[model samples]
Target: MSYAGALWLAVQEDLYTGICNGTRENGDINRPKIIREESKGCLECFDDYFLSQCFHLSRPCLTFLLDFIKTRLKKNVFNPVSDSTSTESIILATLFFYAHGFLPSKITAKLGLNHTFAGEAVNTTSKILSELSSSFITFPASYNDRMGVAQGFKNISGIPNVVGVLGCFHVKVTPPPSELSLFLNTLGYPSVTVQMVSDVDGNLLSVEQCYPGGTREQYVWERSTICQEFVSFRHGQTWVIGGRGLPPGRHVLTPVERSQLKTSAARRFNITHSRVMTYNQHVFGCLKARFQCLNDLGTVQADALESVACIIKACCVLHNISKKFSVPLPREPVLEPVHPTQDVKGKEGEKSFYYMEETREDMIETCFGQIRDEEEKEANTEGWL
Candidate 1:
């Protein structure tokens, strides 16, 4: 039978049973004599069923739940509990009334109690439930530890790459700044620096939040140091650090070479009008433009921008590794042209695309130059030279 049919039959059976059990006059069960109108006792019957199912005070789970309620009450965490009238029956009655969205008068009439008692019970129970919900339903620390870094890189996708592709293309809503601040505050640091890491699939691998009470540069330095340490300990793969320059060979382009590639990519991707000026800007803009172009050209959405970000991040990790090992990079891989084609399923065929060797080289050079310029300015100001 249909669910509606079954529900109707059940309702009929309940009504029949209620009629067989005649109303009592003195025990708050009889229809009020003053009304002299036919009343169905629907509220009372609903209250009885709901209370019977939900309020089993003798059950272990109920006992545990009540214990939590009592503890919060003793802590004076709830305003309702602070105003006295803290009985188990009142708590249960309050829970029932609020759970069903009943007014105090309605609840009192249904449960055979005074309106004042019902009101007090509801107020106290609501406060307790509120506190419980707030304190109990929280994301675990491990979830933050795992997801924090991945979210940062996801944001980086909006920053363009040398190929005019959106490197971190995956749309991810990060935790609000206030929430991040609260999380940092809980770390018991005057100031914290966070280094985020992601995998080839744009999955967040780890987040290292460090205490570095200093200037912005100092914080960045400390976080980089922490990132280096984490990479060394976790991956042990030498090709995982930043700022060491791209893999060496004719195939790989240096910063200057990558700048040319960016200009070419911008033109090819119809983004020449955007006119990305700086190397950093070019790198950021190219990736963003490329993704849009790819989407337009393929007539399909490519969800691999974040994956590209991960690949770049992983290469940065290798640069860090090179610094740690004091070793030069290996030869660059041969570049292969990836052709766009529509498969039988009307989807873009899978193809291999290479990062322009010069693009990464330029990024490292730009980073180093900025660092050196800052150091030089600091030295000249201090007259140490």
Candidate 2:
């Protein structure tokens, strides 16, 4: 049998037995007559018809998955739950959630566990997810490496030397009490400016983060580090604004001057430039646009786009893309069969038991038959050969 087919059978077997035997109300094995009959039939059916459905994995792969779970659980990063909840149950429920995006009740039926236990498990697992999100999700270091590098600009327009061009935009966030409110609050305001040294590519380099309420002088000074990094990397790159170039000189503009210049430029270009007033504005805009483009992409594509954005932002600040930074991305790992036989027993003569029942073959055939009928109806509607 194919590896995947074998793996599926093994997983079903493991789950059925693991739940029935692992949870005992009293010392005696709670083998109801119905459960025993079902299990016997299931075993026979498995041996005769689905023997090929078993899977194996390398030791390293198994270790990796276990270690990942252990690390998260040990840190108490999981969602907060009642003290009575079992960590093992939480972890299993979490795995199901991640794989299928279902709620606890749905997973309870699939795993053959009590609904209340499943709910508690999901809560605990959510804590772990929350912790992972906070600790692991980060912008790529490539962003720093590629900061201060511009792309797509080839010509100049009307202003005396441009000391810096800022990208401004507002990031709309739902008000307080929302899940994303914290990040919005961190920005201190909705609008922000992103100042980068412009390049031949018409892209801004050396991105920096800042509040929206700061004065023009404060904004420029706040971004001075990024500017300095950019300049250091590209020794001779000039800063252009409008049509003029600002020779290498420390120039700080007042709020009035910056506002007036921005207004005049917007008029001339017929493009709205008010959004480029703060660092938060710029970063949020860039991120939103990039994420939207990647929403439908596969995991690899999404990851690549995220990396590219980070690198581009970094190059804009550093004026080079060679620096290294680590970016964490979501990864899906292969799951292995969970054997209940390995679990510890509380007392002598205590043994874990599982119930597996043979589902009627006719039931399976009927389901497939229904699916075929549906497909034929759709095909007829579409007039497909």
Alpha-carbon lDDT, every model: 0.32, 0.32
lDDT of the structure predicted as candidate 1: 0.32
The reply for model 2, stretches above 4 Å from the true place, is 1-67, 74-89, 95-106, 139-264, 267-385
Summarize candidate 1's per-residue lDDT along 1-385 as a digit string, tens digits.
1123245335434433443354334654422222222343222233333322333112333344556566666665444344222444455555433222233343344344577766655555544554342233221124343244324322433212211111111111222344433222212322222233323222223322222212132233233533344234332211222211222222212223333544433222222212221222232222222112111111111222232233223223322222333332122212111111111111122111134344444544453345556877999989964
lDDT of residue 280 for candidate 2: 26
Model 2 over residues 52-137: C-alpha lDDT tens digits?
A: 12111122322343355455666664354333224444554444333223333544554456787775654454444433432232
Give each model a TM-score. Answer: 0.25, 0.26
Per-prediction RMSD in angstroms?
Answer: 24.3, 26.2
Task: Give candidate 1 regions above 4 Å deviation.
Answer: 1-60, 74-86, 104-113, 143-385
